[model samples]
Target: MLRVLLRTNALDDRVRKTLVDTLYTQPTNLAIGAITGVLCSLVAASYAPDRIFLELALLLTAIAAARIVMAVMLPRLRNRDARRMELLYEFGAFTYSAVLGVFAAMTVWYQLPATAQLLMVAYAIGYGTGIAARNAGRPSISIGQMILIFTPINVALWNGEDLAHRALAVAIVLLWIGMISITMTVFHTLRDSVAAAETSARLAEKMQHLARTDVVTGLHNRAGLNHYLVEYMSRRRAMPNLALFWLDLDKFKDINDALGHQVGDRVLSEVAQRLRAQAKQEAVIGRFGGDEFILACDVRDRREAETIALAVLADVTRPIRIDDDRLEIACSMGIALQPDDGEDLETLFQGADLALYHAKVNGRNQISFYDPSMSRNLVRRREIEAELRLALQRDELSIFFQPIVDLSTGRIRAFEALVRWFHPVKGELRPDEFIPVAEETGAIITLGNWITAQAARAAAQWPDDVTVAVNLSPLQIKAPGAAMGILNALREARLPAHRLELEITETVLLDHSKQTEDFMAELSAAGVRFALDDFGTGYSSLGYLNKYPFGKIKVDRSFVSGVNAGKKSDAIIRAVSGMASTLDMQIVAEGLETIEQVQAVQAAGCTLGQGYYFSRAVPDYLAGMLLARERERLDGPKRAIA
Candidate 1:
């Protein structure tokens, strides 16, 4: 019974908030009701002039005072403190209903002027509206309040000694029953509306959770980790002992490629389980993306954090069986401690990432802590990337050409264009300084196109026997419509595709698709010649030689750099030259700095050579001068100054 009473009385936050909002209109309603009561009292006094007259007037005045007091007090309380405010308002409301019930029964108990009945009817209409407004959300209160107002009226009507008065009492009882039905319906509608709102809010919260969670591993995704990081940093002043571990599975791609992604996914799930088991209840473990996880730990000392990191690495690398085969895993982790590495999340992540990179670069399957100087190289790289972007837009980048000589004839054959950067503050930057940076940032596509156009235009002015060679980044050919763009540039320059040689590495074919094969075929059909650049350096060199039909093979400088001192390089060069001869492919040996090195490469049957010994890479005008000298030699000249 106690539980039932509590359940009936309790209104939820939403309903209580609604009740507070409706109470703001109570003041005006009470004042109007008070005025109607005064008029009713006057009419009753004129009719009675006796015992009930003064008593009725004072009773109405008291009820009006109680209502007016509630009107003034109710709206002042905060909506959040709704239970106390609602109780107080309900007490005032009960009093008003009881007093008004007695007033409604006045006509049956005492003789009154006909106009006094009119006043009572008007007061009852206002009373019914108040019940609907206050008690719709609370059905028990509506029942009690309505009963208090109408019970006395029914009693006074049935007390009369006549059929007409008894019939009137029956009619009032029926009407009260109808009002009770309306109260129950209104209560149900309000309850369902509140329930639906609560349900909707809960479903929205679930959707937010799914958005931040990883589906496969069931760990916090990058978004979820970022969310925790923001909250953690916001209160970082209070909790200063924290460390983040950017954990990576070393050479995990090899597993995916060799065993398949399905096996890889199972391994990842097992890894997540191990991390969760190793992590403390307070530690946050998140999937940083594929094959990578981040562990955030709360520890006072760096040694404690390092211990935890080592334990996690040990657990991750334990031999685990997948597909009935036991396999060993390797993991690399980078740790960033609070305040020492960074104070902000982005800086912390960058520091941790750089540490992870160093761990991988040194060797896989190890742990490294962040040091301040570790970011100097990263900062410099970022600075170079930023400046390189501006270099392209400002036209501060230019092309330089190195001459490739026909060793058999001792004449200049073709020039290879190399990109050079003119930094105003740093002087000249070579391709070794910025070319890898350009490829990593995808700036090579833009830089490559510009060089191709420039070299093509310069080559358009050369003799038919001479050719212009340009190096293409792997990124440029991998792009969509890349071959078409190169074709368009060459066609626009009116340079025959035969006089243009595109140099590519064997690595380019490692991940290339049939589209790449189709692209090469289209260019080859258009008379665009190709050379396998840096040959014999890649693992799949001989395979690429058979795979791609090349007009030339440029032997990498590593072999030629050791040409004079070693017989292995000489034999390898001889073997490559022999292969090139059988395949009808021209061979160019680079990095000939000494007369002995030049003679070694020439004896190995290399068709051409390029090095500082012949001439370093120079501007377009200088290359044109070298070509003019070659023409003069072909025509009438005996010799020219080297």
Candidate 2:
């Protein structure tokens, strides 16, 4: 029964058909050989006597030998067309076909009664036809092949030869066909079902990958990285020496602001490719959303891991291309080693991120190993950030106006607006301490807008002859239509554009030079003037001095303070004054502290100056009174030289 099922099972159509063809062909050939041998022997039985039977036997032997040879050699004939395994199946079919022929011939040689001879003949024919039908789409059906010992039981019983036997024979053939067909159907269904299930599973996996992976850089997102960390923790016992590296790109936002987002995307992809190439062979690298990337590795020790990290940094530090532009991108890397940094996944990640902060703080584009104290610093920074947001809401900030003096006339011309924060509980906070924190936390936008508005309002109450100068943060300039915001505030305050000066640092100009230039050009067109505040500090200032129509160039305190101390300072001031003189630009020397410093700046031909020697930054009300007193003092100077 197993053999029959194996031959007929629909595991594969080709194999089943090959087996059935062999079975059917064998019986057909056998029945033909048997009938021929029997008829020849019986006909010669009367004429040739004993020799007649021998002759028939010899013919039968030759025919059976031919059949056997054909069975064995048939596969070789189709060797080029059939696969090795398939050809083997065909050979087995041929052998079965020959076996049927030999069995029938042997029965004839035995001189069995006509009835038995006929039965053997019929069985052989039925088996041969079944074999032929296995391979061919069409094959001749043999009535003789259908009848056998089983056939007599069915045919003979109906004719009163043996009713019970014939009925059992018919039942067995029907049951066999039914079992084989059902088994074949099951096998076919199983194969199809498994194939479909596998395809669906693969498609689902691809979809999940797309969701987790970054489309431009092919890195995992923050959510994906979080899940990866969780999975790592689950098997962390086995990977006790695992390490995670977190990396963030420096000045990436500048690239987006300068170039376009399209180029930025290309640059990011290039960075990702470089990272993937240089990362440890065993490490899993992923993007932790936007300019951040992550690497999880299994390392033996700190030394081994540092070597990998150093290599990665070196490779990534190389220039990358975004179309026609080449960018020098660098990453600040932080390492957290498992079982050492922290036992749990979240703690380990937090430690690594904190270390990354240290890398950025000290100087970007460097690496730092995770330390226990980093977590403390991280907590403190988070607290600062929260407080900063609160400070903006509670109006804990105050503005101080510093006088801009005329170095030659010794009279104040305008006031520069400076911001000071009082933390209520923390007493006073300097701009250097809190300004950076605000910029990093994106609080600068709100703070800067308020400052601009406040300064404009305060300047409105000042004499028409005096102007207010406010410095703009880089974030503010890049904050989309920032010039419009300034203009709106000035208009709302009813302050003329000429009465409001915007102090821009050399850093802000260089950071987004094109944007800054465009903004300055637009506002300058509207009659608002630009001052190069803290000039002589950055390399781009001298170049910028010629590019835009600046109303004034404030001599950086470094130059102003050391004017009498060094020839270089004096020459710098003299050259700036000379340049302003030639271009008709006003020169304001800041930090004029003494009689000598004031004389030097005035001698350098600077027209405007400001310093503590004149007046420190004071409240709006005090500044108004101070301005009035300064005007009176200038008008009443040298009254009683006594």
**Candidate with the greatest TM-score versus the true structure:** 2
lDDT (tens digit, per residue) of candidate 2 on 8-89: 3434544434433443345456456545544543443333334644554455456555555644555445433323434444
lDDT of 2: 0.71
Worst-scoring 10-residue span by lDDT in model 1: 1-10
lDDT of candidate 1 over 1-642, digit per residue (tens): 245336645656765566445544657765786767666665665666566666766776777777687678767655446666657667766766776677667765664555665466446545765575456666556667777777787787688777876776787677667776787677667666776777798899999899899887989999999997778666644345688899999868778877899999899999999999999787778999988899887787788888998999999999989977787899999989877888788888988898898787676799999988888877877888999999988888998999999988878889999999999999988788798778878998988999999999999988888899999887898788988999998999999989989998876777555666877888999899999888877454587777776889999898988544478888999998998899998999999898888999999989999999999999999998988877787765444433
lDDT of each: 0.80, 0.71
lDDT for position 409 in model 2: 66
- Candidate RMSDs in Å, in order, are 8.1, 11.7
Displacement of residue 36 (Cα, Å) in model 2 is 48
